[model samples]
Target: MIIRPRPHWIHLLFVRRGSLLPRILSQQIFVLLLSCAVVVVHGQLFHWKVTLTSAPFSLMGVALAIFLGFRINASYDRYWEARRLWGTVLIEGRNLARHALTLTGGGVDARPFVLGLIAFAMAMRNQFRGRPRQEGLEGLLPAETVARVQAARCAPALILLWLGQWLQGVREAGHLSPMLAQHMERSVDELSAALGGCERIANTPLPFTYTVILHRSSYLYCMMLPFGLVDTIGWMTPLVVGFVSYTFFALEALSDEIEEPFGTMPNDLALDAIVAGIEASLRELLGETPAPAPQPDAAFILN
Candidate 1:
């Protein structure tokens, strides 16, 4: 997901950050010790030695490669599903705010309602990441309503509740007709569906048994690899095994990081940016003198 080329030393540092370094290095050390033992024992046993087989490499290599492929494929599916759901949320949020503002002929103060929609988007993003909703809702919500929504267990639902109440209030004040209220309520329903889709992706994951099996099998294969190659390749086994282990294990860690895209990861969904965009769009609709600019990244990254 990081598109630009990194400097050589920086890329080297990332090898440790990949989460596979500890396991791979531990396995490598164990293999080195085992190789030393074999050399020592063979010298004592009248120059007898055991060489690893290339046949198992050919067969198990194909099988293990296939398993890793399947695991990556499943993880990508989950990542893409999360992205699609959030994209739907962005669209539905704009529609809800637009409906509330224009549906009443722009007579009432739609700024609060429009800001509420933006706040809802940020709240949903924070909810998924298990973060506190303190910052993003500031300009986008009334003080009293923001406090209430912050105290509520489900932030998205609380935002929807506020939207419903506002629509009801508009009707009571003879600002909007019941028919328009119904139409606005249907728009809220679409936003709710988008929230539900997001929750579905977060709650359900690929089967636990399958994930455990792949991880266990991968570790076993990695542990056995140096032993299988040592007799022939000798010290060269470390370099080869290290490179191969890095590839497989790095991919595994990358998949885990991206599988849930709402988190505070490098390749996560740009929720902050997206919510800021919604605010800009709504403020433009309100005919504000100076519409707020898009959220700027701090050092090329959103905090």
Candidate 2:
């Protein structure tokens, strides 16, 4: 997602990167042309005057706007919740890494378990995006462990499993106490819950029918809008309709982008940045001087 400080008021008015303008430009153009055609034909498709009037459109348009508002609200709820879940990810990752480091006390080799935490973050990010397993972990983990986790159906879950086994072995070897092990177990459980929460949002979207209805209603309203206003607005129907069409089209497009917050869209959650932060912070806790943090794109987008 685009991560930048706020801009000036004038810049906000014209800012294009984080806005829905890019996605809805084609739709806006189509609506503008449709409005122009209605104006040319004088709101009459053939010779029929289209039989559409301002009264019904005004009533229907209000209802449609309300419906669109609800859709945007729902999408924002999903977006905000996804963000909170990932916040939990960051907190719990730090907790896990710190606990493991202290438990090992520079004797039991904490790097492997720390490496598992890093792998879990990477795997979870890829899983949320529905991408295949990632590479580049051969140097951090044993080749066999890396290969096994990557080949698993859910790579993040597999990494957690390996971490659990390591924890159990440490306890059995009398290196870690049961109470501290249980604390680590609780942190791992929280990690698993965070994963499940992300999966829920990624897999379960707003119903298809709801989107279909909203899309059809938006298009119909925008198309017939000119016909309704052509009588009162006269030659200015195209200009007025263009502005109104932009509002509705932009809302619809924004709703679609934010509804699924785990994707690589400009407005989706910044999984890449979040994962990088987790990796770097965990390594620092393990007393390893890591490289610089991740950087955003030219547009300040993290993903």
Backbone clashes for every candidate come to 0, 0
Q: Give the number of the best model, judged by lDDT.
A: 2
Q: Write the per-residue lDDT of candidate 1 for residues 250-301, one digit (tens) a residue.
A: 6666666667767766555666666666667666767764356553333322
| Model 2 TM-score relative to the real fold | 0.92
Q: What is the lDDT of candidate 2?
A: 0.84
Tens digit of lDDT per residue, candidate 2, span 37-114? Answer: 888888887688766778998798899999999999999999999998888878988887788777654468877888
RMSD of each: 4.7, 2.4
The 10-residue segment of model 2 with minimum total lDDT is 294-303
Q: Candidate 1: what lDDT?
A: 0.71
